[model samples]
Target: MVERCKDAGITILPSAGPVAEMFNGKKIASSTRARDLKEGQYPAAVYVPRADTVERFLAPQSTSATAPSRAPHAILI
Candidate 1:
């Protein structure tokens, strides 16, 4: 799915706090949806590129990435 996203020219920004580091950071992570699928998915971990190597990556992304508890209807994508 991630390969497909890249092939389709889709920029898959991380959806969760820990995963956001992948695009430009050393951590490998994923969205909550991915975590829920862990039982069915084989690889629990993923490889993410470091932010130091990329210019498009966002910094302190986790802070702004969070959706408010009151605004549960907000769409992250």
Candidate 2:
């Protein structure tokens, strides 16, 4: 995955297996098709698709940031 991303610049690839995020022992997100994103020199980060996330556990915040390649992203509270 890393090698492929390095060759293509920033890229997203499927994870090897199920991935989940937990907070205070409660699952907030999970996915079998989670994506592994590699950008620049940063460490790879896993992103679970919105459809698979537990929306109830998230609260929108007023903060947001824009990137050159993507839309403005809101901060989750």
The top-ranked prediction according to TM-score is: 2
Best by lDDT: 2
lDDT score for candidate 2 against the true structure? 0.75
Deviating ranges (above 4 Å) for candidate 1: 1-15, 19-40, 52-77
Evaluated at residue 35, the lDDT of candidate 2 is 82
Task: State the weakest 10-residue window (summed lDDT) of model 1.
Answer: 68-77
- The TM-score values for the models, in the order shown, are 0.19, 0.76
lDDT of each: 0.32, 0.75
Per-residue lDDT of 1-77 in model 2, one digit per residue for the tens?
Answer: 54354444777888889998898898988899898887889898787888887889887766665654443565362
Model 2 poorest ten-residue lDDT run? 68-77
| lDDT tens readout by residue for model 1, 1-77 | 33223322333333344444353344333334431112123433333433323443333333232433222232211
Superposed by TM-score, candidate 2 places the C-alpha of residue 14 at a distance from the truth, in angstroms, of 0.4
